[model samples]
Target: LLAAAERGDYAEYGGTSVTWAEMEAYFAQTTGFRRPLPWEPGEAADQIAGNIAWAEMNLDAAFEAARTTGWLDLDQYHQQRRLLIHQQLLRTAAFEMPAISTEEARAHYEAHLEDYALPFQFWMRHIFLSCYETHRVEEGETPTSIAEAIAGDRAAALEIRAMNHRRLVSGWDVPVDEIDERVGPLPAGFRLLVPGGPDRRAEVRARLAEIRESIHSEADFIAAARQFSEVEVRNRGEEIGPLPQRGEEFLPELEEIGRTLPIGEVSDIVETKHGFQLAMVTRRTGDQHRPFEDVRESIVSALRRERRNELMLDWMRGLLQGRGIAVDDVSSAEFAAADASSERVVARLQGEDPITLGELRANWEGLNAAQRARYAERPEEYLLAHLLFERTDVLDEIAEEESSAWMAPLLHIYDLVTVAEPFISHQIAEAAAQITEEDLLAQYGASPERYRQPARVSYDEIALRADPPSASPEEGVPDPTEMLMDQLAESLGSVNSLGAFRRVLAEYAIDLRAVTASPERSSQFRDVPLEAVPIEVRAHLASAEPNTVIGPFANQRLVRALWLISRTDDYLPPFEEMRSRVSLDVQAQRRSTLNTQWRSEALERERFELVRPDPLPAPSEATEP
Candidate 1:
């Protein structure tokens, strides 16, 4: 049927041949199917015939509705009916997707909690102050230590204090944790002092009272903060969190201050190298292990997935049990007979067993190749038991242990999801297969403008590196001006043309390599170091043209470049060359059509049971009565 469609069989079945075969072929190509295969192993061809019948039923129904309801514009109605039938057919063949459950959602959620955990850091603001870099150089103390240099003399203490005083008014804020480790602990002298120092304690108290008045709203606090606070809060206000983990990531002084600050309240100015900051806790959430209530929706979602999986498995078991979709499980002995190539070694050692390759590799040889190489290099670091894989007894031991345990539940779940829903899977595959060769050609014909070649040009390069002092001792040797000028002149005269450039090296005792590039190629010489070439050669090549050569400017070594310009072969690929692309286009169009068809069919097949047609009173009636 698919082949017939690919040959445009459906085109003759209608008034104005709507190439359905082309549509199907497009689907197959887009999805990478060369041609459609027959339905699954046990499914009879009659089942495919029934699916086609369902597609026609939906298409006829849609066509009738369009005729009875004259509201549809002619061309649009035809297009819509085509799309509708395609969707309906897809769904009737059991292509409608199934829903996931809460159980599955929760399980997925639990597996990815790292995504939910807050970022492993917090925002912190701090002020910094330090002696000027120039002052350090002038002090002439390449210092035993920063502390010793600052504390050893009165002059040093004065410079340090002066630096801090200047920074009090100008320094910007920074994360305290980033401050120099050498600067032992934050000093108490860095704390904020009342304006007018000893005389204005009462005035400072009044300012704190005013700040308290606007603490109720973030907007009010920000406005008050900008006018009065000295901390470097940006124009938009401070964003100071995700606070780091409690015990591990904070300094003693910084931690104490952070932990003590109440929500919405500011702390007295804290100082670090950046200067001073009056910190505030804009928000705080206490650490509490989330309760089931908080995660119950997620858990329910997971439950639904698990339950759906269970239902799917049950469905698959029924199919395999009597529907002839799967063969019965064979005995272990029968299974063993199917694989006669493996040696059936019996262990001679008492209580020993033959080891399976999977078990041995899983328990031992599964180390990455590099690690395995290291292990092979030095066998001593690994456990003694892992090295016992050479013994045949390990297999029997694994077999005996296997008989005592049940398969893991997750494996059973996976098996069901895989085995169930064969019908839907089959339908999807059928829809995918409908795309064909003729369909591809039609699509390619429709859009000739889409496939064009890109512009291309060709060029070549010569690469040389400027020798460093260690690499070329001669490069470092200062040359006499007369000798240098004479060498430069000699190098410049080496290459006037391609033939002359090639032989110049033999005549002048200079070594050089030439490269050519065509526009069709990624020229290797583009990355060559021009500085390494003789200065005159570099300058000459810079101005040279296609099939032209100039050379012999001297800096380090001198060489000339020859280039060829090739016109790009920019043309659209032939149809056979672009068949795959056309196939893709066809497949996409088919799938979209099939999806619409499937939805339509599924909705028509669904049996809805509603007891009351007009359960609610109309708004107009309610208002009138």
Candidate 2:
């Protein structure tokens, strides 16, 4: 392949191609390279046998796709043209190797030295222990009861805590060597730390030990880790890379230590919410300006991208030069001879679809039938909500059209004041650039709230076992509680009213009735059985609506019911409390708006004159020489 390329044989049989001549000109202007001319000797033979075959194939496919899928559409035609031009440029540019000098690379590296500096921090890991405050259960529960519950649950928590200490951190204030593989700059613990509290600090401590251990050479610890570390695949004994430097990169207290550690040594255990980590600097490389030799590869890559871009423009320019592809000026296009002569053209362009009165009526009837079908199949409330979303556009248009004179001008102005930028840009690509800060701010303020979180409820539930076989032979039925509960539950679909739910249970033959009690006191009824209670009672309790009653249910002579005794609204901290989050959201919105507007304005002003509109545009103009 190399020999073929050297012989210029690759250019004929397979090579890059571009249609935009201007881009090629830009590349030539920027890099002082000779531009290939199509009419030059051997050009046609090259096209038949050279590397540009892939580009030609793509162009053929694009034209085929356009022809198959209504290429007569202006938008479709334009899209194909753009793609064909870009592909040609890419194909041509990639195969042509740039001839850049070492001196140029060095100069470029010197100019962008800051881009290559290493972060001034060490990543660490450590073992950690968390100090937790004890909270007693409500006064009524006995010590024995609490102890029993704790026995079942506390062992797992304690086991995890022990692992945190051993696996995450080492002893306090000790230098770190052979830091745990699990510990790094953006360690897992860093993500879970509780904000602004004592736990947060303790978490920081736990992670510090691991961080401290990483920097020093501890052959013994590394060997031990290779033998017994529980972190996945640690047993396979793979060498881990040094941690990255960014603080936000880590999950917990370890991140803090990583950001703060001195370059040469281990850091103290950093306590993170999940565990402790001791961080160590296995190796440190300080920031130094990159030499030309160091950044030569990157500069070459950049130049190639620029060159490809220019080649693409050049290919397009060449294609259009003698192709007779003409476009009317934006302002005068509306009055073009072809457009004016054809009524069909006028009808399509002016948003008028040629339809007879009968056809319009038929469409209206079809829509009415669909609406009726939807209404019949869904609940009224559900249907209403669905319609609200589906018909919002129509509603907005109707509201605008029907607006009163007194209100119309204000609304129009407000819309223009708000949507003018986005709307105009939508219609005319360049117009969006005209949107100003005031315009955006006005829209932003008027915009509906965009940062709401879904409403969530946290609740505890207890499910009692219900058995059908427990009924006596003489009884000829399941236990009253169970029977009543099931019967009352099945009485209706989706219980909504307390009275209706109660009526269901009253009609059933239950041994015990279902009841709902306050969540604060739910523990008192743990012994209740499901057979005795009503289904509505359980549903109501689950939902937690106020002033609801569950029916008498029976199970093995036991009764059950439900209650919704307490409720809590979804809680999100105030904006001031979440300033960082709000700031990020606001900034992202600003950036998106700014970038979109800038692109729109740039395009609109140029009026499709050219991608490189400047007939005299040079590639060197894109970046500093």
Candidate 3:
């Protein structure tokens, strides 16, 4: 400060925070009236001094200009942002429906009883005659005659498969080890049977035909199934229980066979991709209507879901149609090929709003590589949904109609606060130098609680969703949630390094693709709560340091492999470290007094009644100057 430098009171500050003593120096310098401190570097001191000298000459004029223009514009900007969000969230609570009654649910159940029937399931068994062969050279052919053409006859292959079916029907099977030795090793798409798996279809068809010839009764068919048959049903002698009702859930050939097979007779040879089979319908559960009590909950759930979906769909459709929403069909391949950086228009909505390529990428960014690949098959559905919900601003009319009623009072208060800020600061500035340096130091000493720091630490988390048991699973059964947890336990039970941690994740198929999560080098879980994380994992996070790999813990279906990248423990920084911050604290302290004084003056000058409810004061830092 000019007065201080002439009296020599300058000192060191400003690497991290301004302390109590140096806070005084900052006050003298930042008031825009004091000359630069002598402790400031040579050229820096003169440069700052010259700038302060110029500000000192026109400081009052600058404040007046700001009070007239800047704060008014800022108030409008804040109000507009609030209005946009406020209108979109408003609802009168009238649209929400009451819970459905039991009588209503039962009445609806009687009319659509068939819709609630359990899927046409079968209690049936089958005989599978697999075609497993060595593929050896025939007696007529020799290794010396390699140049000569070899047999590629389907009929010959069919004969061999038929002979195997005859052997299975007669209670015989080839040992898996012998088959494995002769066939070298089983190839891809052949995992149904252990050691030796599924066979080629030419043989499968022949085997089915042979089974049709051999199976004369339920006894014979069951006998043949016991001797042979592969896949999951082999354990139950080729019995596929709880038969699928949906065509898509099973092989087309098998579903057709189930539908047409006589109640007590053998099915004709069914040529399915897995193998050939002869089915016998042992029991049928589809003809009888299901009991009302058994389906009561489902019927009620269906009706509620139907009502909700219809309401939402109608609302969405009206919105889209009203806005004249239109889409341009961009093939997934074309969208992929376009410049990823460019804002090239992929589609447009309401004849005017362009949906860009970059926006489309962001739309699909939340899905993992597998999910993205799956969605690529239905590009139109993904794009249209994204456009409607995420990209389009649907609140324009609502904001105009409703924002004033909901937001007017709040906006008025905000306007008052923004407009009054600069004038309050000018009032504080006028009294700032008059307080005297000793009294300022006395005030700093009195407010030690202002320098208190709360305990704040940053942490990291790894979130993983467990894989489903079967790629194509039954609709209502609960899924297995151990996929990632089991893998992480086996793979990372002893992992030590970050490289090993990453390798374990890659091995187990846990990739971080959260929409808002970034894979930072350190401390990524500052906003995440400890309770949301798995209990087993919290110990590792609390104990581990940077680059430490620490989990395979599960919270419901999500399994994780957390890495504690770094931590920042809660402690107050040393006074020198907080000198700059303390300097701002001094300005805020002075401003609070001016604000209180200005409010009193405002009460006398203004005519408006205050309707705001007053609450007891909460302890808080003074507003920054």
TM-score of each predicted structure versus truth: 0.28, 0.27, 0.29
Poorly placed runs, candidate 2 (over 4 Å): 1-98, 119-217, 220-241, 245-256, 259-267, 289-294, 307-625
Compared with the true structure, all predictions reach lDDT values of 0.40, 0.38, 0.51
572-604: candidate 1 lDDT, tens digit per residue? 778999988777777777766776577456534
Best model per TM-score: 3
lDDT of 3 at 298: 80
Model 3, range 475-527, lDDT digits (tens) per residue?
A: 54334455445655777777776566654432332222111111122224663
lDDT value, residue 392 of candidate 2? 24
Candidate 3 off by > 4 Å: 1-92, 110-114, 137-224, 230-238, 244-256, 262-276, 287-625
Evaluated against the true structure, the overall lDDT of model 3 is 0.51
**Top-lDDT candidate index:** 3
- Regions of candidate 1 where Cα sits further than 4 Å from its true position: 1-136, 139-147, 151-237, 245-259, 271-276, 287-301, 304-625
Candidate 3 at residue 555, lDDT?
A: 64
User: Candidate 2 has what TM-score?
Assistant: 0.27
Q: In terms of TM-score, how similar is model 3 to the real structure?
A: 0.29
